[model samples]
Target: MRLVESRLTLTVSYALLALFAFIALFPIALLVLNSLKPAAQIVQNPLALPETIRWENFTNAWNHARFSTTFLNSFIITGTTIVLVCTTSSLTAYVIARRKIKSWKILTFYLLATTTAPIQLYIFPLYFGFAKLGLINNIFGVALIYTALYSPFAVMLLRTYFIAVPKELEEAAIVDGATHWQVFWRVMLPIVSPGILTVALIIGLNSWNEFLIAITFLQKQENVTAVIAFFLLSGQYSSDWGEIMAAALIIVIPVVALFVFMQKRFIEGMAGGSVKG
Candidate 1:
């Protein structure tokens, strides 16, 4: 009887998980279905498969959105943000992880507090200051903003990896006549690299999909990211649903591919960080 009950429970759990998966994937299925249909067909029956697939929707969207240019702009911003976040946050995380100083504790708390704080709290003053300095529409400037906003979270995340490293390694490095920089570069960094890769993927995804900050800072047509370009496809009076979906898929495919390929590293880094030493 116990064996039968265990089998029943396992079956029920699988059924529930399958149901949840369908719920999550249904919208994405609809988006893919509609992306191949014309606007007229979408209006007629959104759920129905297209009788004739319109491959031209992608071409039209590519041209209309100026994806060639916008994609390059997004690459610059996202790549810049990733590099900045990783470099700075790794150093900050290392210091916080190793130091037992009171000031470091306070600094960690301050960064945590800022994570919970609303962006609007400082965006106005920051925006106005940047505008005064003529930093608006500058890709590098927008990257700086992303670095400030996202680095705190990255630091917090990376600290876990650093904390996991054995302190004896750093001491041994010092005893071997290695300087602090050498100790960090040779000993700590290699160990925490998985965590860094995870941080890079998460930060890159956020930077690519970030709408409000990107739209606000990158106003010029030539400077806007792919997300902004996708947004411009729609307007108050009208929208091209088919093309909009196509554009969304374009932006999503690469990110999804990256995640799928690197999912092991991402999961390992996150899981490793959560285990208590």
Candidate 2:
């Protein structure tokens, strides 16, 4: 009886997990399915498999969205933001973790508060300022905005990783006549690299998918990011649902591929930073 009950419990657990997995994947499956169908077919039956696969949808999406240019813009913004955030946040996290400052708690609180605060509060002001500075359609300018918006969270997350490093390592490096910069650059950064990779992946994903700030600051056609380009594919009166789905799929592919590739390091970083010593 006991053995039977255990088998039953295990079966039920697997069943529930499979159900949740299906639920999570269903929308993505639908998106891929619809991308190969005609717009009229999708309207008639989204669940039905395409009678004739439409490979041209992908080509049409790429051309109509001008992904060639917009993808380059996205890469520029994402790369710049990642570099700036990682460089600054790692330094800041190291200082906060290693230094014995009384106001560190206050600074941490401020970062936490800012992370929760809505970007909507500052959007108008930021737009006006960027316009005055002639940065409205500048890729680098948008990157700077992403850096500021993302840095607080990056600093807070990296602080935990820095705190997890053994203090004796820093002391030993210092005793060997290493300067503070050398200690931080040569010793601490390498140990905390997984955390940095994790941060980069996160910031890259956010920067790529971010629409509001991208659309607002990059008004010029040539400067728009891929997300903005994808958004522009929809018409006020009508939209090609197949092409739209194809565009959406194209946008998601890079992000998904990247996450799959870096998932191991990302997991390690998250686990490493979970507990502070």
Please, what is the whole-model Cα lDDT of each candidate in the order they appear? 0.88, 0.88
**Which is the leading candidate under TM-score?**
1
What are the C-alpha RMSDs, in order, of all predicted structures?
Answer: 2.6, 2.9
lDDT of 1: 0.88
Q: Give one digit per residue, the lDDT tens place, for model 1 in 1-277.
A: 3546677898998899999999999999988898898899999999999988988889988888889999999999999999999999999999999884669989999999988888889989988998999999999999999999999989999998899999999999999999889998989999999889889988898898998888888888889898898888755212778888887788888988887899887666556536786
In candidate 2 the C-alpha lDDT for residue 57 amounts to: 88
TM-score of each: 0.92, 0.91
Give the CA lDDT, 0 to 100, for residue 101 in model 2.
75
Q: Model 1 has how many clashing residue pairs?
A: 0
Model 1 residue pairs with clashes:
none
RMSD of 1: 2.6
